[model samples]
Target chain A: MSNYSKVSEFKDGVKKGIPIGVGYLAVSFTFGIWAVEGGIPLPLVVFISLSNLTSAGQFAGTGLMLGLASYFEIGLSVFVINIRYMLMSLSLSQKLDRSTKVGQKLLFGYGITDEVFAIASTREREVTAHYMYGLILTPVIGWTLGTFMGAAVGIILPERLQVAMGIGLYAMFIAIIVPPAKHSLAILCTILISVGIMCLIKYVPFIKIGEGFALIIATVAASAVMAALAPIKDREGDAHE
Target chain B: MNKEMYYFVAAVVMALVSYIPRALPITLFTKQIRSRFIRSFLYYVPYAVLGGLTFPGIFYCTDSFWTALVGTLVALIVAFFEKSLVIVAAAAVLSVFLSGLFL
Candidate 1:
């Protein structure tokens, strides 16, 4: 894609990803409220939501914070929970044009969460810088505004409702996973492995690794195993179509 | 204003850090892939990450193992048949709520 076309494509891509941004806003707003109710300072809540930009990591991190966890605990927790992003970046690194500057690759890589990565990777042609920027704008704005709004309006929200807000993230996860599970045994097995491992880790006393670290190990290990076991056959020009 | 300002600053810094990873690739990479191994790798990354992320999210809500288990099973069942996000969420949340009542 030429420079001018990349700019045009960016606009088009932003339009496509707006619905996702809206969904994120709904979820992040709830997260902000949860953070405030947990006694997190509004700024801290905003920081967490903006910095992490991940429902799972921020959720786990807040769970720790509310428990008065140590700094090491918080860092370790987010690290484990977010290790999957490293893998996502690694995988996505291959799709970029080789000419992509290292700085550009590194910058765009930081925001590659589950939803953003899914939307960006599905496009047939090469992903342009402009398009990625456009995609990030709506989600970034939505998430930030949601967090700020949630924190500002925190006084009215009840604990019960805060817990209920969790359903938004859960719902989004379900929406992403269900269709693929129906079509592919490989996917179902992957899900089962992840859940089973998580369950055993959560319950089994001897194997009591902390949740964040456990998440890191489980997701990376399960994904690597799945990838090794069922290598996908490549289709011609599928990525660029 | 003091507290809010701090958080807003924190947000900008974090956002800057986060945006780098997400926007970098799209800005720089516009090249075609000619390698077979690389192509297959990209295709499967989404599926793998989706599976990895989804499975954990379903059961990680709390220590109420049975309730979470039941709720996730119900959600997965509803979700599997092409349910919408709202429907799947309702299934999971209601399942958890109802199970909480009994268990």
Candidate 2:
């Protein structure tokens, strides 16, 4: 009975992960093309996707590296861009099944991307290590495979097509934030504040900020302002509640 | 370090910074967060980060400003109604390709 249940849970997770895997294939393909176009070697590009499995962090980090930014800048930018995963990890830790082992938790914790966390946290039952593993498998494969394919194909892609595809990543970013911002005033304000800061740093001669530092400042300043102005009400399982 | 070596090292640094935030919280902390301010900051940060990265940079993505603008508008419209990442991305790319012919 235990074996049957575990198998079913793993299967369920794989089923849920399919759509996310398909999406990653498209996005990571773009990442591969962009990174290679920026002069990153094909193998290293694939390695970045395999190891990091993040969209924004990888893009920002690669952009910095191509520009020969300092290691400090790369580290700080990636950290700030990815710090939200910590919150998702915290939320997922509480939802993990009590029977899950420490080793299992640590291993699967590495797989907690935004999409994975969203699916795992919303499961009606406690998330099992098996389920997490199954959920991570397809997306990881898609991300890595897509990178490899894109890097290879990018070499032969025409310059005009490459330029057109340059808009792919930013377009995806628009797709991500637009729906939510349309629904919520706070989100709209957050986006506007960040964009305003970025513009100042770009156009204002006196500002003089590095690309990595600019991103960190904009992200922190915007998030801090929105958080202070509109604190979220405590929900169930919150310590204060 | 040579250029390739520096690139590899940078990739490693990025991987470490990316992994630590993800692994540490789940491995070390089990208790729910009590602070509303911290919770709210995390909640709002991703959107702000995405916004900061997209704009201005998106403007410079293509050869001409007009192509990028048209692509951005198409992405926003498709994403507003469709909500599929691939479709939104594809629509924008197609729009830019078609517009690039004339612009």
Candidate 3:
């Protein structure tokens, strides 16, 4: 780990980040159209793209907008959709440099999206501020720029095409979960429990609440149960430090 | 009362909501994790959350739940083979498009 210069490592991160950035362009393009077609102004769409890098939360926020939902509803939904980032960041914090400055930590946390979290966790060596910065740089730019272009020309796409592209987001989600779920029964159970909880909350009327609450409750319940019932033993070399 | 004002406000709020979660954990947790249970629980959060988000919602993405289900199933099968993101998404969209033609 000491052999490589930070510059080269950072460059490696940027290089690794390119494919993610390209993928972001496609998915965020769909997000852009979804927001814009829902009647949000182009500049506002651009503002959202620039300010918030979250995809699912942003999609849900747009829905809240269309429904003219209250500020509290919008806020709570975004919170619920994005609360998983907190978990991801907490998990990755184990890997970050101990001497990492607060400012750097702030930057690290700011970029803690699903893909960034996954990449940071799976990297072979310890994560540093420079590499993390490089890792997020391109994907962030790609995400924002894609949104701009999508909003600017989104009218070109037909409804059928948009609906078809909607699956792209779910495809990416499946790509992330399915591989790992195949490996571990705990993870498989977690997915099943979550889906079941969501179905129960969504389909049945009595406890059927807002989607935001349902999602948050389902996620928390499923993770808690799976973690307690089927805790994964740490593999060798999975040292905490 | 105008639509512009509402959207701008919503976007601003969304940005704040987005920033807090992403940044909070890094700022607060400067030490290593002490609890095995917490670690285990956190480990499953991503999987659980993704599953929660994908289902029910994926089924609702298209006008026809059946088409979306077929698409999601295609995505899962294709992803199991460890395909790239683009291919995964393309296979999903194609499934829905083809299904739409027949059903």
RMSD of each: 5.4, 5.5, 3.9
> What is the C-alpha lDDT profile of model 1 across B1-103, one tens digit per residue?
3545544443444344444444444445445555664555455556555554556565656336676787778777887788865677667767766666666
TM-score for candidate 1: 0.68
User: Which lDDT value does model 2 have at A161?
Assistant: 76
Whole-model alpha-carbon lDDT for candidate 2 = 0.80
Which candidate achieves the best TM-score against the true structure? 3
lDDT of 2 by residue, B21-99 (tens): 8888877865555687877776676677778878889888888999999999999899889577668878988998899
Give the per-residue lDDT digits (tens) of candidate 3, residues B1-103.
8889988898889989999988888779887666777777766777787788788888888878888989989999999998875678789988988888776
Which candidate ranks first by DockQ, i.e. highest? Answer: 3
Order of models, best TM-score first: 3, 2, 1
- The estimated TM-scores of all candidates read 0.68, 0.69, 0.79
Q: Please give the range of 10 consecutive residues that has the lowest summed lDDT in model 2 chain A.
A: A232-241
The sequence of per-residue lDDT tens digits that candidate 1 reaches over residues A76-141 is: 656666655665665565555455566656655656777777666655566666677777777877
For candidate 2, give the docking quality class from DockQ. medium
Give the higher-DockQ candidate: 1 or 3: 3
Output the number of the lDDT-best candidate: 2
lDDT of each: 0.63, 0.80, 0.79
Docking class of 3: medium
User: For residues A100-200, what per-residue lDDT tens digits would candidate 2 score against the true structure?
Assistant: 77787778777788667656764656678889988998889888888988997853246677778778767767877888788788889999999999999
Chain B alone, TM-score, model 1: 0.76
